[model samples]
Target chain A: MKSLLTQPIFSFFVTIGLFYFFKIIYTKYPFALLNPVMLSVITLILYLKSFQIPYEEYFEGAKVISFFLGPAVVALAVPLHEQMVEIKKRKSPLLISVGVASIIGVLAAAGIAHALGASSEVVASIAPKSVTAPIAMGIAQKINGIPSLTTAIVIATGILGAVLGPGFLRLCGIKDPLAFGFAMGSASHGIGTARALEEGELQGSVAGLAMALNGVATATVTPFLIKLFF
Target chain B: MIESLFFLFCFLILGEFISTLLTLPIPGSVIGMVLLTVALEFNIVKAETVKPSSKILLNNLSLLFIPPGVGLMVYFNIINEYFLPIVISYFVSTFAVLYISGIIVQRLDRS
Candidate 1:
């Protein structure tokens, strides 16, 4: 059985099969907490745990899936590149908005966490929660917070921002494409960018730009914010 | 499809190896991104080679987050302890950033 697991095609189809099963639940239920990724992962983990399947055994296939993240992010550059003309025209505004949003995100999250009686570590971990996972982890680690916890917070933040951003933007009276894109990117990262893409190409491109800029901005700002606070 | 999968696996293994060598504080995926960027810049790899696999992976990027999110189940105590403040602060701040930044950018564009 273990030897049979080494077949790449078998592993590939099995993972996809698992993903399809959860994707259905995700579509049918649409619960915030029951996010497709979260659901699929839980299902996979539980299946492995119950069957005494080691992570190594599962990773044989899962790693193939994970490997594609790099090129995926790079491909984002295509949509973004296509929007270069608009991006150049609005470059300054985009930069300023992303910068301000990053600072506000760090301050707002940290301040509220502190206000609600969270430990210093918890407060700090959530400070960079809006950025992508890798950068968020680095920011968290830099400020002496737990990287694992920071990853969790960042994912939750991304999902919430993605799910709620459009309705919230309408509520806030933001209808401009560039404005919508920047706000979603700054607030949510990739998940929100996905939502933005579905809305329109221009919005998606701007959101992609925002996601990259947010990564850069939060990385630069969070350390400074940490210094200012401590 | 098979060839695309092979190239992707190689890219990931290379990324993992590079990540292990580097002392950067970021995740391997981020490092992998950087590595991919450099490879593209130098023409060590063409965008076409990675495009197909990357497309499929990124389209379903949200799926990757599931395991870690479920890991939150283990941290229920920590979450419960900080639930109110975290939720309130995170959402309020998120919305504020969206609203304020949108206004600021639009204003700047006009000015």
Candidate 2:
């Protein structure tokens, strides 16, 4: 049984099967903490570690899925296209808000991490944690951070934002759907957008726009921002 | 389907080329995304050419994240050591972005 499961194909099957499996559970429960990414990552890690399987072995099958992340990043252009009318009508405000958030997102995370002595690489990694994983990984590499660690922190940041962002916004008396969406996308990326979609259409599209825009904004700003922290 | 992916890959490669040429801090995938958006806007690449493929990838974007997330296992010790700093920064930064961005957009949007 152990040998059968270690086959490269098993990793592929298990990853996809586990993700959708948790996704189904999320749909049924709709609990923020029950995020599919978090659940799937935890279960897969336990599986790999307990069985003494190396990450490289698991990655062999998984890399095929991972390669799609690149094309998917490009594909994000499509949603930005679909949301153009909304993005255009409110262009300046949307751009301004995302710009400010992008800066704060980096400074706040990296600043706190630095002050607490998270080491050079951790500071750099956490700086781009709020951006989507693909873009965040890229920014991490250029900024002298660990790309893989950035990937994990990016996912964790998304789950944190999805679970808490809405409630936090409401507590602050933010009622507009666009505000909610922009906050979610800029702070949490795609996972936050998924949670935004459950609220309404306006929130969903705006969040998608924010996610794409924040990726660019954060990538552009990080090189400059790290100077302040480092 | 193949056509959509083919066009997307072209843009992806183009993005990497530009990033390398200019020494931009941004990633090739990001540069590619921006180029793709512009191309679609200018009618250089028909929107229909990429829509279907984009849909499938976007729908499973989280799935694409798993392989890397799984790699987090290797860094478990580091994450454990810096747990407090990581947690504090995660909460504080995420909420800061959320509250401030939401308010900024709201006030500026209405005006």
What CA root-mean-square deviation does each model show from the true structure?
4.9, 2.6
lDDT tens digits by residue: candidate 2, B10-77: 99999989989997655677788889988988989988999889888877777887787788788788
DockQ of each: 0.37, 0.65
Q: Alpha carbon lDDT of residue A190, candidate 2?
A: 75
Pairs clashing within candidate 1: A37-B66, A38-B66
Candidate 2 residue pairs that clash = none
How accurately is candidate 1 docked according to DockQ? 0.37
Give the per-residue lDDT of model 2 (tens digit) for A1-230.
98777788999999999999999999999876787888888999999999999989999888898888778778878867777777788788888998999998899999999999898988998899999887898899989998878888888888778777888899998888888888998999877876676686578668877887899899989989998658
TM-score per candidate: 0.76, 0.88
Error of 2 at A212 (Å): 4.3
Compared with the true structure, all predictions reach lDDT values of 0.71, 0.85
Model 1 lDDT tens row, A17-38? 7778877886798655655554
